[model samples]
Target: MPIEQGSSGNNNVGIGNSNPNAMLTVGGGAPLFLNQGASSTTPFLAVLNSAYPTDARYGWAFYDNSTNGNLDIFRRNGTSQGIQFMSFNRNTGDVAIGESSPLFLNHGSSNSTPFLAVLNSVNPTDAKYGWAFYDNSTNGNLDIFRRNGTSQGIKLMSFNRNTGDVAIGESTPLYLNHGASNSTPFLAVLNSVNPTDAKYGWAFYDNPINGNLDIFRRNGTSQGIQLMSFDRNSGDVSIGTSNSNGNKLAVRGTIGCEEIVVKSASTWNWPDYVFSKDYKLKSLQEVKEYVEENHHLPEIPSAQEIEKKGFMLAEMNMNLLKKIEELTLYMIDQEKKTEQLKSIILKQNEIILNQSKRLEKLENKL
Candidate 1:
């Protein structure tokens, strides 16, 4: 080995070439190598050491004695020495960015702040242009933030792994919003086509004026033909504006089903009051007179009224039952009167027969 040292003030040392600008330089095709003895406490490479006892010191390529001789970066502050900023598992090749103990690749851990923060660092005033990931200790959720030059970044999204629910643009998202704007917050699903489809498969539109959420399905190119709508303010549902013309579960086409059942609870007011004794039953004569005057049964809606306003089936059925009950009462009264009349005729006939027999006996004597 040949060594050439420069003059006392020049402070230059060259191994193969002379006139070196650096303090130490090696020339030729040979490579510079450093060999260190196997020690868990010593570093293989060190850049700069602290001159004073109070200054903070940094080093690279240090062997960690705590992690079973794992290679790591060391940062020292005063008498305290540790791998405070970063650590690496040489065997596993797992790098921890801001954690002393990394469980996985790119693992970040902190106590009072975000576990991971990616900063732009291009401009200090607008330096909040990045992302942050942290656990929300307040709500016990995983929150992801998007920085917009604010002190605390805006929470753009969250996820609850336990419930398997992901929230976007809101802390607690019941549903997802595609167009998350203040003016128009809606979602649209488009159909796939060769030349690009103009038809929407489905769309959810938010109506701020009515406070309704309108869901639309595309029949053709007509967008926002409402299939259904939910009113948040009044809790009303509108359906089939897109398929049919009416509201509240309207359908254009015919529906085929095995059975359609409508259950009316007992709390519903039924028309059993018509059968009560206090119910006023009109006489047959009065009913006939009324029918002749009005050309319709009493308490029944006329054809003209039915045409004007649709009839309710339940109400009409009750009215018809009342009329039937009235007819039954009339029949019972008429039957009793007929039986009494028949009895009187039979008694008169018997009396006439007896008088005839007595007259015949007098004629025979003469």
Candidate 2:
């Protein structure tokens, strides 16, 4: 009987073991059996550090909480009992991390670090390939990272807690506030080759300073070159140009559109009002005098004014219509005068014919 228990198992026992410290220690790559007949539901196994925790929290433990019937596999983390990091509810058959009461499968709730990580193949070549998601307690942000994907180091997406901002490829996004002030960006995507180079990226944000929605893209290292912008204050739009010049739309380049619609005022505002009886249709003489003095038609903008302020297309159309209506009225007056002159010419012809007949009768009497 080489197996011996020293006086009712009071002293330490060893099987192929050299340490005399452990009460029951198994060595030589063999399994250590605690008990063969104990209830499996009874939690008893624990692996701990050298010093015992006076608080009775095991450093490495497999135990049932007894309160919620949850079996927890715990490991030490920064001097705290991290049981919920890997816990399974015996009652609900739920596996969770950092969740006190898990209801579904693999439900994880965490604040500072990621609850789960799915790394690339366990091979050595995949060292820098992985994805992680976590809620950052420091900035109250939710961030997702791809180890080495888009442009450079590992920032895929981030959501800010305070500003409702979503940023991709940029950590600290800069935006413009309603008053054209520089606020943090709402959503940005930048993949430029260098930090100082804005040559290859684009951003969408609300400019705090300009109070407009701006779409900015980098082209050959240019910064803040807006591809398009919509003014929040004036409802103006600009393309290839940042300044709308108070116009509804301003384009720095040529535009080719299938159709463009510019709405005018109501029907009553059309130039048909010029034909109304109450309308003062200036005489042709008056118009001639005005054109001679001003070198332009009356009630029409001058060429200098058009060049300076730019004319409205719809307004100009209405003004041209008014001039055409005035011309038509002048033609009507001229036609009436021509009819009167024709009547006078016919009566003169009748008088000449009658006088010639009287002379003929006198000659017959002679």
Where model 2 places Cα greater than 4 Å from the true spot, the runs are 1-116, 120-130, 133-155, 158-186, 193-196, 204-214, 229-256, 259-268, 334-366
lDDT of 2 by residue, 1-366 (tens): 134343545575555544322354344233232322222232234444422221233455455666656666555442445444455768645454443322123234244234333334221113344555656677777766664522223656666677555555554443322222232233445554122345456656677677788777755454567788889989999999778988888888888989989765565378787778899888888889999999999989999999898787788887888888888888898999999999999999999999999999999999
39 Cα displacement, candidate 2 (Å): 21
Per-residue C-alpha lDDT of model 1 across residues 93-125, encoded as one tens digit per residue: 544444322222323332224555554532122
In Å, residue 308's CA in model 2 sits off its true spot by: 1.7
Please give each candidate's TM-score. Answer: 0.39, 0.48
The best candidate in terms of lDDT:
2
Winner by TM-score? 2
